[model samples]
Target: MERAQPLPSYLVHRYQGWKATGYADNQSWYRRLAELGQHPRAMVISCCDSRVHVTSIFGADQGEFFIHRNIANLVPPFAPDGDYHGTSAAIEYAVTALKVAHLIVLGHSSCGGVKGFHERCLGRAPELAEKTSFVGRWIDLLKPGYERLGGNDADIDSATLEKEAVKVSLENLLTFPFVQEAVDQDKLTLHGVWNDIGEGGLEYYDAKSKAFRPV
Candidate 1:
């Protein structure tokens, strides 16, 4: 095993600053959180985009939300195969162990993952179509959503497909038996949300309207 080196100077400076301010101000609260463990009320599955700050957007405090970030905030159909499924593992832990009351699939506009999937479907990104591309396979989970957008349409915009991706994930969540049980027993509620990063606007899926409404 390789020995880890010290953090970069900038990261060290930032850590020191946070320790002195954010950490010092909430010493007692932090201690209480450590002692009691976490009881977050919700789990947020979102994109790995740096611009999407999950905690800041919701004004969440420490131990308030269990979050999992991936290429496109996608959830695959329940596959019990004995393989490494990071996203599925997180979902199982959150639904069964954490028993979170709410599960949110948050997608954002201008998502690179969604765009890549779109391009690949249109035969523009042959690289992503390769079997060895990790990201290609990951975003392939969004194939269903892309098809919903009329896959062959050359003019399909990124924004439209981004929202559809959210709904696709929400649908896939139902494939997980535990998640289905929770919903059936009224113990858990599922939500699909899209964020307009540039405008700082939020939209939620309305089942009745089958459309995204501003929140």
Candidate 2:
């Protein structure tokens, strides 16, 4: 194990500013949250991209959304074979332990991971084709979506594939028996969302319409 280095000067200054402002203003709120423990109503699985701010998007307060971020905002089909699975572990905790009522799979436009996967499947980006590549392997979970959408050549463009990544994650969430049971019991609801980072617009999946509509 290695001791992490001290924070950079800029980050230290930013932390100080937050402590002096946001933290100071909400000191009691923070203390109460620490005492109560987080019981967020929804669990949001979002991309690791910097531009997608879940709190800012929904104007959420602390303890309002339990957020788990990963590459491409993906959720692989449940596999409980004793393998190390960070995303699945988080999902299990959020559903079974936290009992979150809503689970959201949020994808975004201009996602580098999705673009890389799309390019890789098209016989480009040879680096991503390697099994040892972490990004490649993680985004591979979204392949079922591409296959269902017609395999990278189905007249659909790259952006639609990004949205389909959201759809894939939603479908995969159901593969977990706990998640499925919760949904069946009406204790949990699943949602798929695609955000246009540049446009600052959100599109939500509609099961009945089988399409994404802007909100």
Candidate 3:
């Protein structure tokens, strides 16, 4: 392993503040979580954007939500192709091992990854096509999502595709047998959420209405 570095000065200061405040106030709760282990009821898959705060949005306590963040908040089609699937592993552990009651796919506006995927797929960004581009390959997962939504138009607005990313992930999450089985047994529920960062508004996908309504 590479040599490990100490925490940055700012991070250390923040840690000390939290230890004196949040952690100190929740010592028993923290000890309980440590002793009993985490039994979060929901697993949230959200974009790795610094602006999207899942816990704060839901007013969730520290151990209440198990969160997995990735580029564009994507969940690939269940392809047990024996590749290094970090997202898949997290989902598997959350659903089968943790037995989470809910799986939430959260999307957001102004996502850099989504923008990258949109521009890259539509041929607007040629630099992302280079072989060494990691973002290009990661964003490539959004291709199947766009195709499912029948959005091949290079001129289509990226914001629309960003919402479709949540839809595609919700669809793809069912491809996992464990998730499907859990839902079939009514042991688990699936949710899709979109966050409008600029407006401070949240829209929830209503399967019956087939639309996102403000929550």
What is the alpha-carbon lDDT of model 1 when measured against the actual structure?
0.94
**Candidate 2: where is the Cα deviation over 4 Å?**
1-3
Q: State every prediction's TM-score relative to the real structure.
A: 0.97, 0.97, 0.93
Model 1: residues with Cα > 4 Å off, grouped in runs = none
Give the clashing pairs for model 2: none
- Give the Cα lDDT of each candidate: 0.94, 0.94, 0.89
Q: Write the per-residue lDDT of candidate 2 for residues 25-79, one digit (tens) a residue.
A: 9999999999999999999999999999999999999999999999999999999
The candidate 3 region of ten consecutive residues with least summed lDDT is 150-159
lDDT tens string, model 3, 1-215? 47988989999999999999999998999999999999999999999999999999999997899899999999988999988998999999999999999999999999999898777767799999888997788778787767766665545666678888888899989999989999999999999999999999999899998788899
User: Which prediction has more favorable TM-score, 2 or 3?
Assistant: 2
- lDDT (Cα, 0-100) at 96 in candidate 1: 99
User: What is the per-residue lDDT of model 1 for residues 93-118, given as tens digits with 9 covering 90 to 100?
Assistant: 99999999999999999899998888
- Report residue 183 deviation for candidate 1 (angstroms): 0.5
Clashing pairs in 1: none
